[model samples]
Target: MRLSSKHVLVLSIASMAGHGAMAGQAESKGFIEDSHLDFMTRNLYWNHDYHSGHNNAQRTADRDRREWGQTFRLDFSSGFTQGLVGFGVDLSGYTVIKLDGGAGHSGQAGVLVPEGNSTAHEASSAGANLKVRVSETELKYGNNLRPYNPVFAPADARLTPATATGFWVVSNELKGLVAEAAHLTAAKDFNSTNLSDDFFAAYAGVASDTVDFLGASYSVTDQLSVSLYGAEYKDIWRQYYGNANYTYPLSDNQSLNFDANLYRTVDEGSSRAGDIDTTAYSLAAAYTWGAHTFKLTYQKIHGDQPFDYLGMGPGTFHDSIYLANSSQLVDFNGPNEKSWGAFYNLDMAAYGVPGLSFGARYIVGRDVDGSRMDADSPYNFYGSERSEDHWERDLEVKYVVQEGSAKGLSVRVRQATHRIGNGASDASADQVRLIVEYPWSIF
Candidate 1:
């Protein structure tokens, strides 16, 4: 007999209860006493101009993108019941309305509302999670999840956030160390109604039944930290990751920071992804002094196929520290791509403006070798064999209210220009985004 997801969650939770740490702090405020309700409201506007002309098929097929949406998110959590095996629940939901969107008038790219006969007009979803806690350990099962591991993470750049159905446990029983594990069966994109074995498996021409993972993070000292993680997608691929970071103080208000990330991936079981043998890595260095900060980054992809990853849909965004390239609407993850970037940031607080900041960055990618792509792949694989280069420039400004009724109101503006050095791909575009968010607490 096949066990349902709910059954597996129950059994797993029960089995791990005996090993729960009993050193947790008791909630003297009680279960209902410590409950919380919060709301986050977001307003988004997006504009992009495709400059590939008739040289790219996609550019000729779609028009310039311009749209706006208003989104609302609600969160509710009940404190654990006062007992050895404390139980609790978390609830989250979102409601989004398209202020302005139309077919043939815009290109979505999964950043605004998804294009579904006019971006579905509006979309909404609700999710719930059951949780249990003992000492510093927690076990949870639900539709709303955000996994920070290297393999997967939720996409939150759209009007509605992505969700996944899974069972996970996290423990911090040992000081300075954190351990986590999970088994996920399905996922929902930011703009979809149903959950399925999609995201990562679809790229490989097969459906993944489950994804299991184990991970740990350790802080060796006040200035050094490290992490390791491993995961397997049934009938798909196996992936492993490692990361390290260090900070060194130089003088009273200056410091230097270094970060490195690595990933090793291999095809597993059925080899549906087709003999995937790739190793990818990146390094970043930054120096900070008072209100001024500067950073440099280098990344490389080593394989026949592009460095791939899972996303809500169409790869709207990611939380990976390895592939950051100024959010120029492209991740620069092309096969065998080599990229270098420089960043500059200024904090306005030093100039008497406590709630304002600005930043700018530039990234250049070269050595992209996409020659071994399988033309018959179902998913739209932009794997290119011809060597080419691309560059992007990004600028951002942000501010927040410091006091009074609108104290928590925050606003951010971002602009980017991306162009291919010698190609005619629709990936080249100029984009601008404006976002506003406000949070409120309700007891």
Candidate 2:
């Protein structure tokens, strides 16, 4: 007697097709195809020194050890049908092998753990996602690892987020306009495959089963766009976001870009037992000339406590780039904490290599107060007992084959160093990562 959401969607599409035919609507149908097979390997080495000692560190609890691992991922995408409305799907998975690690070393954060025995079974997991398309829209149900915005996901590092089982809808019904909505209830961490409801408690206390979000985007012109979004966790919290981006051609060979974002959040119901009210903002500007691109960003958070939100896991890193590194936690875009970053990127194509690039970035955060730590333990929250200032510098280089048998082969390396002052936590460390990928079209 009950119908699944996918089945409902299919029936709706069929009904729409019938109606369109009766109305003499335009009719066209075709099946398009696309796919990517990738093999990615990652290696990380961390050297960390606790600010308040290991027991008092924000991220580490019992001791400090250098850890490393190798991770592999394969992702694929498919195109949908062509007509008044269409449909499609996506699939992806990952595997992690110890390579070199021990009991005290394994499961530090995003790394996978071997199953019953440390030999091999414990370190591998795989999953897939299914999506349906209707016209310029899509509806996805199943496992998904990609999440947008700085306040919603923890993606400042090379590792990915845990997969989430939910339903997401995106639509582009009108030119230059986009809309999105989602209702997710279960999740699995980056290194996990078995779905769990644990995050819901940390996110909204004990009574909620769904996380709902709605958002829209519009492009005002060729180089200007704006967005507004809202998210609500029943009996938990409600948050809103607004952002704008613009790009101007200063000349034939130079351009200027600007971005601004603002967020406001507050508690919602009986589950909103914590003291939390937050507001944050960020502004950024960039200049591009010839082969060089330079950028600068400034951010601030205003709240009694640091800005806090959902995250992938304990070892996840947070940053200000709302796209790749969503800024989250206490003092995030809050009062008492301020941040700034500088970055530069180069396109080798301008010099001759069409598929090579390099980039460097530096970021600093100051005036972070951790006087009020959360009751769930340090790792579960953002604040510590000490006020601290931190800085991070990163460098990366990447290349992709332009043609031939390995045309889609890609290789990249990244290195980063973080330092903390004022004895804040154990997040300060030096890290290096290596990744190689090859995508083969199987259409």
Candidate 3:
């Protein structure tokens, strides 16, 4: 049986209300007794080397962009008060200090906010949210949200993660089901200290007044789950997403998994992005034996326009695209693009070296034809290109301290190389990122 978006939303709300009524209010301890405070520090070194000819013409002096910075994030969550309807608050603050990267190397890398020809030495911001709860349903309103849903997820790939100013509802009263709704008005970019930054489309660079979305996920069985979501970007477009995931155990130390994600987007209202109508999807399969796993993925776009999502600022790319083919350096989401990838992962726990891991992936895309795009659309710049292609290769290694005073300390390194055909507009580059993080818990 097929269910429309409206039907799914209604059903989810009805189920949530019914279950919440039956469950009654949850018993809460004193707010101070259940409160928590956490502090984390992240040190990052980012480097991007553009191939000689692929460098941006506007930044002719910057063939290689690099930045080194350290970020301190503090989060506090207060427990609900004892009552039929409980109340709580969440607070978050972030501060970043630049350790390296001057005018010649800081160019648009998004690791730090640029000031004149140089970069900011320090930046900081703070936010708070108020929350209310009854049974298993909760609502939050404020600027400290970092949602991870497919429709409007924020990115944390740089020194700091993006945050949104909005209201959101979550209900988990029903068993094995999660339902959510959100309305976002603005966002704070990772590199900016502004608490209320405008939201823009990644590819079109057009601002959006607001974003609203509804979603639900249900676990059908022990090994199967599915999710559905719908969203509207004010007057720009409407988007719908669906996902299915399954895992089967083949033996005591072996398993197989499959995941699929699909999206349908169409222009709406004013169509500010200009006549966008696209269908994009990805399918992935993986097999694991002992501590080793291998995966393969295929992704495709069936429209004249490329698949796009929310962007935080001028250069801060959001992680709203949940496709399997989106990798470290490229999204592989050109107009009418088809891509395939292979990935491998290794864990050292089986070899008595816990807290160490390695991973690698390679993806290639082809048949990127954008010549048929609308003449006035934001993507018209790509209309001169046809039958383009690109490929990327990535490698990563990470280690975490398992036991001792620095038990939670972690260090990770990632490297990627991307090359695009001449017909494509994207620049070819080699990128490397080194990250070190440690966390502390304070009452």
Clashing pairs in 3: none
Residue 376 in model 2: lDDT: 53
Candidates sorted on lDDT, descending: 3, 1, 2
State each model's CA lDDT, in order. Answer: 0.73, 0.59, 0.84
What's the lDDT of the predicted structure labeled candidate 3? 0.84
> Lowest-lDDT window of 10 residues in candidate 1?
312-321
Per-residue alpha-carbon lDDT of model 1 for 1-443, expressed as tens digits?
Answer: 97543455456455544554576635435578878999999898888777762333445555487778899999999888887767889999888788887456744545444433353667777888998888777888898776776776666766677777888888777778887778887777776655562556433445566777777889999999999987777667778889999999998889999999888888778876666777888888999999999999998889766565664443334454355552556767666788999999999999999999999999998877756766654322544536768888999999998999888898999999988876432267898989899888888
TM-scores of all predicted structures: 0.89, 0.77, 0.94
Worst 10 residues of 2 by lDDT: 19-28
Ordered from best to worst TM-score, the candidate numbers read 3, 1, 2
lDDT, candidate 3, at 256: 100
**Candidate 2: tens digits of C-alpha lDDT, residues 1-443:** 87543454455344433321211112223334334455554554433333342323434652343345566666666555555545556777666655544456433434444321234433555656676665555677776645564334534243434665677666665678776666677656554556653344232234345566767789999999999887766565677889999999999889999999887767666544365576777788999998899999888777655444564333333332353222222223323568888889999999999999999988778776545535652222334544567777888899999999888788787777666665444355555566665556554
Scored against the true structure, residue 58 in model 1 reaches a CA lDDT of 48
Candidate 3 per-residue C-alpha lDDT over 1-443 given as tens digits, one digit per residue, 9 for 90 to 100: 97544455556555565564524345678578779999999999988887743423444556688888899999999988877778899999888888887456645567765322244578788999998877888788999888889998888877778889988778988788898987788888887777777787788878786888899899999999999998888778899999999999999999999999999999877888999989999999999999999999999999999998988775456887989999998898888999999999999999999999999999999988888898898876565677888899999999999999999999999999999866636778899999999999988
Give me the candidate number with maximum TM-score.
3
Tell me how far the alpha carbon of residue 132 in candidate 2 is from the true structure, in angstroms, after superposition: 3.4
TM-score of 3: 0.94
